[model samples]
Target: RDRGGRGDRGDRGGHRGGGHAALLPPGRTPGGTQHAAKEGRASLRVSGVHGPEAGLNGIYLPTDVESHDFSCWHQNDSFYKVWLCRGPRAFWIFQPASQRGTAQGFMISKERHLERPQDATTWRLWRDGGWKVFSTIHVREASPKDVDSDAARGRAPPKKPP
Candidate 1:
């Protein structure tokens, strides 16, 4: 689903203080591992990784959790939009286009609760038959240099030219 409002900035759910969890940088495993198997285009099992520290803004989903319904504040509109989705295992920060190299999808899950927080935007996911937390990311504010460097390269890129 396109969250952005008719612009590239909103295309990937990018807006000031918009609570959209950022997808894990390509090639980096969710649990912070650096192995080849976890670095490829494999559908990651939620149980494979450890949970994040408490209080960090991120998405969490129980493995057996089949659906998720949640809401977050809209930066531009200053209102909350109810987000809903149903699937085998919930994914917090999902990339819409597998190979488009842009965050252009919606964050979906089952059984969303609570109202939008004015100061902080947060959400949770259920995976591995348990609940987990994930934080939304604001990509538009990212620096051009950083964005270029952070693009998802299926395999590690060669060293930059001097």
Candidate 2:
């Protein structure tokens, strides 16, 4: 997640203008153009779940975005969902815990705002006996309307027991 601070300045693919770009070694520009990553949005979908958060299996959009760093996603209520980060090996999803309704769901990126996994990958959440586990993750481009719809749904009042 783009923390919006200097925390992600070290390894983020792109370089921010003004002070940071001047520090780079000569003759080597950043991977992409400046502010290029802030163009679009991404969607992350979790499937084949076998844990507490199984019912939360759906498309997640980026909740927080940064101009130079990748976006990050978490549930609106809690923080148990997976975080998308630019790991040594492309994109990786890290699930901190297994608490249900821990947080909201959203998609994020590194280097590129619209970046998605090359293919559906499996990930394991082994914390506390695997409280949140999934077999497949799907990433894709998300439109602004899509995001607004999901946000509306999230804001809708909960229904009472029938």
Whole-model lDDT per candidate: 0.25, 0.34
TM-score list, all predictions: 0.22, 0.38
Question: Which residues of candidate 1, in runs, are more than 4 Å off?
Answer: 1-120, 134-140, 151-162
lDDT of 1 by residue, 101-143 (tens): 2322233222222221221244333333233345442212223
lDDT of candidate 2 over 107-147, digit per residue (tens): 21222223444243434333332123333533444455655
Angstrom error at residue 118, model 1:
13
- The most accurate candidate by TM-score is 2
Q: Candidate 1 — worst ten consecutive residues by lDDT sum?
A: 71-80
Off by over 4 Å in 2: 1-37, 63-69, 76-82, 88-91, 96-115, 127-149, 155-162
How high is the lDDT of residue 79 in model 1?
18
